[model samples]
Target: MDGKVIFIGGGPGDPELLTLKAYNVIKKADVIIYAGSLVNRDVLNCAKNDSIIKNSASMNLDEILDLMEKSVKNGKLVARVHTGDPAIYGAIGEQIEGLKEKKISFEIIPGVSSFFAAAAALETELTLPEVSQTVIITRPEGRTPKPSAEAISKLAKHQATMCIFLGVQMIEDVVNDLLTHYKPETPAAVVQKASWPDEKIVKGTLNNISNKVHEAGITKTAMIVVGDVLDTEGITPSKLYDKEFTHEYRKGQLN
Candidate 1:
């Protein structure tokens, strides 16, 4: 190949959310391939005027690789963009494997995930001193099969905070699976089109989140976060900034 391919995480939906590195890559790219159905079109505004841009939504895996291989062979810099952090459920693994077989060099650039944007939208932390210290990111099985051990019901037993991706359309089933271990009163939330102009959030308990999400008409392109982390009531304050806490930085103030 004459050039390299760069896989970029385009962030949630806001063009401003693009990292400086991602912005520069888009600006310098000679070709851009992106997920059209899920990615925000505005993110492409930074692309070079003469850049070759293609939407991968209608293309098969082989087609995507073919384009990348061709572009790289032509001595052109190609940008492969995906919404949110490309590492999480971004399906980059298969592409990486294909690249390896073809010996096409590439690099990955991480971006702000929708779960983080969802937390920002809710103005809450996913982890707290006395609340959940774990954030389990998974998706309920759909056409994409998941390991039996990683079932939503099994993950719920940890009582850790959860960031479910691509499961909003099946909210009822997800709630049912979560109910197997999580309390019905446990807080749950859904953030749709996070960071976008029409972003919407649905907050409630597991007992009612399914109905609430349906009522809000959020079917897809959303994040489902659940656990005690969503509830900040009576949580112990973090000790990092507490005067009573001691660390390598300072001594505890004790009289």
Candidate 2:
């Protein structure tokens, strides 16, 4: 009996935000390994009563791989779950590499990322025509160094909407770096544990966001959104929805 591993994105702390495929896989998994610190425990409700569940929070890469390898050899279907989309900051690349080296079969299922959830919670669009055409998803340089070309200050030069991950703990530095390019009054917002029941949102300008976040006591598990898109006062509506615009799906009404 050949076994396999499925990497499921748990979707930003909201169990409902999980993809249907992920839910099904969790339900059918013979063994489930999840990121206990970040993933919502409620998601475990989908698993069988007798399923073997392990929390990877305290486990290192080798220990995790050992568990996966042992489970696979025993012909058990394993579900390796991570918070938000596995592709983003979930640190699954190392795990995937280990699996490949061991000749283990695996598949990655996508899920709703925290940034999108944070955007939805704020009821703001990350991109608005003529305002911002690009969204930069990045984090401040911490223990893990970022490429010089992708540094926050460098990226801020475009003044594009930025959704920063793993930087809330360094909000002051993040704000300072962003200020190098963005204006002092540039709109910024932080959403902590987006989509969770007790989620918190703090909105302010680049000059004051750090203070606001500090007041709110948001140290981690937060997304920092910056740019003019948060300004709902003067945004231009998308042309795609304009009644006069023509496209492959619609003909121009005015000509």
Candidate 3:
């Protein structure tokens, strides 16, 4: 098709986090479909004043796709804006499939995901040597039931740093299931609306994080991070920066 559509990741509630490509696309878009409830409204300001903007929060997949199809058929540039990286639970698969069926050309411009923003806000790394060399990103089973193998109870057994998304409403159940594999004192934290102006963070252990989150009243729009990396009291420095470690870029001091 001659008409094109662009899927832009708006990042996690921070207009400044938007990529240059996404910003430019929004500015040039003839039609913009934004996830209003989750994306920061400030990013919408980038769109041309005459652009046709619609909130997809209340719109179903068919409705949204219809809008895009109509706009594209009229030879207009349609921009589908999603919060955070669209690849991560952005539900763009169905939309892409629909676009393909209609033979519409499209491009995806990725943005910063909430998990990375949460990590930045907490000043914590997901992977730490000798602590947690792996990071797992998943969510608790809800209306969308995950495979039994991907269940929290089973994933927790790895003891890797985990970033739980869209599970704040089920924080208690999440913590309880995590306790099955993590120690009571394993450092855990919850970041609400990361990168937003009024963002909130609750830090505690497996035994107390639920209460803390409950007291904070963060029912949604939060990310749960669990691992020893949160306990940044005395982590070993990475070998990459170690003077004694050798690499192609530098000689080992020990040698």
Candidate 4:
């Protein structure tokens, strides 16, 4: 029988956020490979006692491929666990292509991304009428390859609420780039490890975001959320809250 590889999104360092299906699949996995730096150890505890667990934090692409190939060769179901959705910058495409060369079957299991968690943690809606109907998620290009057009300043031109990931280190550059489009007083917030215990939120505008982040001593594992959506007092109520906004889902007032 051909063995299979399961790509599991471990969620934002919180075990409770894991889907029941993911938990079940993990419990039955014969070989589990996880991103040691980000994934919580509590997630690994779900594996069976006899299961083989390995951390991919220090491993190179060849090493990771070798491990998976060896495990599958032994007829063990391998689980490749990632911090969030494996599709976004997870670097799984290369691995999948390698697996294809070896004829290995694989399944991808999506999980709750940090952006959604950040929004929920802040109790702030990403989309609000006239403020911003769209949310853009991107990062400042550094070691990672990004199209020139996708530069932070370019994306900032949209002036839409943005969830910036893996770019805290470049906050100064981020601030400068965003200032080209966003006002210095545009509201922004930095959420460190959303939904996780000890998560921190630092609120400020574009002009002071870096300073606030510096004072908070936050360097990584955080996301930067920017836009007027953070302006709770200045914005009008949602149409759903309007007295005359009738809808089939909920009853509206006649007066």
Candidate 5:
């Protein structure tokens, strides 16, 4: 029917992790543009045999928008694929703005983020009632200018569960910033290539995480998680499931 551009989240590096909707969009699209290195080859293989596939990494924003505009105008379906969830660090904002200027129709399909995948790889709950109920997702500022309020050091003061992205390459700096508020013995973990066959996990306190990660040679594609939740030393059950806890679904039970 009419032409449209659908942005799909490839979900980490596992092809099977692709949402059913994402897989279906890839199967029916006439053109596919995926982020190179970020997306797994197996996920790209879901595209129809005749689908025109292009690596977005090799092209600039103008080139990418040009392709979508041309394809949509020609009444062809274009699937713009990104690694993990398109919302988190997917870099799709500029492309979306471009599509708007050209008046192109587009839809976004959500995918599993690497941070959640990292959580799954560790088999740990991100939120614990008494330990830390807040999970702060952040990154260390690099070439990208981070706002003062979102600075790593400032965010560290909360001492809540923290998942750091794109900072493994400069983990020492990250740890240094974190140490501004977090204790040296605070639990920390690094999960590299989560959900991939070559995934690696490193668990340690803040005092040793940087060295452990460096020794493990994890320079990229890793998720750094910190907080008391990872320790699991004396985690207690949540109020949600407590026998004496009352809610809309169930009445409180008394001893």
Candidate 6:
């Protein structure tokens, strides 16, 4: 009689960005479980009146699994909420594997990542045709092992716009690795506590990014972005905005 478990992405810290589907599921969930340290608590308002809300921050893996098992065995709808997109370093793999061993059906719901929201908060585009055409989302290896191919230094060679998560504490290392390929003057920005009312942004270059980050005393809950995409100073007009350029969305008319 156990019901399904739905893992929902809480989408940065802004409650407004949660998808309609995610909201609907939360509203109907009989058991709402969320990552308390990262997710905004205001999101709990969407849950059903009788729903049992639990914060998983204080619980260990076994404890969390036990809660889920009990909920499902009671034929209750469970919503497992995570901050940002659940797929990225959300630590859901181990949990999902455990669920499989217990024969519990589950579904993952995706949400906008913090990197996208950080870029949006700055009103900047990560990909520019010539300036930079690629976006790399990565993190500096901490306790987790990063593949050699995806190492920060190697990925820097492309000079693609880079968004690094869970690596703010190692900003010095990040700056040094990026310098292996990118110029010292390559524009970079750090968004701290992005999308939240107290969000702060520190903009600089590869040379000074680490220093600026340190100056701000921001050690976590921040995203480090690098490349010309953050270069608001030397912006060239986009072809889409050029009147002489024609496109299906806005064709050029005879002058």
Best by lDDT: 2
CA deviation > 4 Å runs, candidate 4: 240-243, 246-253
Question: RMSD, model 4, all Cα superposed?
Answer: 1.7
- Residue by residue across 32-134, what tens digits does model 6's lDDT show? 9899999988766888789999999998989888888888998989999999899987999999999999998899999878998999988898887678878
Writing each residue's lDDT as its tens digit, candidate 1 over 164-208 gives: 999999999999999999999999999999999999999999999
Better of 4 and 5 by TM-score: 5
Candidates in order have lDDT scores of 0.93, 0.94, 0.93, 0.88, 0.93, 0.89
Extract clashing residue pairs from model 3: none
Q: Candidate 2: where are CA atoms >4 Å away?
A: none
Better of 5 and 6 by TM-score: 5
Spell out the clash pairs found in candidate 1. none
lDDT of 6: 0.89
Provide the lDDT at 30 for model 4: 97
> What shift in Å separates residue 162 of candidate 1 from its native position after superposition?
0.7
How many backbone clashes does every candidate have? Answer: 0, 0, 0, 0, 0, 0
At residue 222, candidate 4 shows an lDDT of: 90
Q: Measured by TM-score, how close is model 4 to the native structure?
A: 0.94
Number of the candidate with higher lDDT, 5 or 6: 5
Count of backbone collisions in candidate 5: 0
Candidate 4 lDDT over residue span 1-255, tens digit each: 367899998888778898787888899999999999878888777899999899999999899888898888888999899987777768899999998898888999998788888888888999988889999999888888899999989999999999999988778888998999999999989999887888999999998999999999999989999999988777777888788788878778888
17-74 per-residue lDDT for model 3 (tens digits) = 9999999999999999999999998998878889999999999999998998888888
Q: Give the lowest summed-lDDT range of ten residues in model 2.
A: 232-241
- Candidate 4 clashes between residue pairs 3 or more apart in a chain or in different chains: none
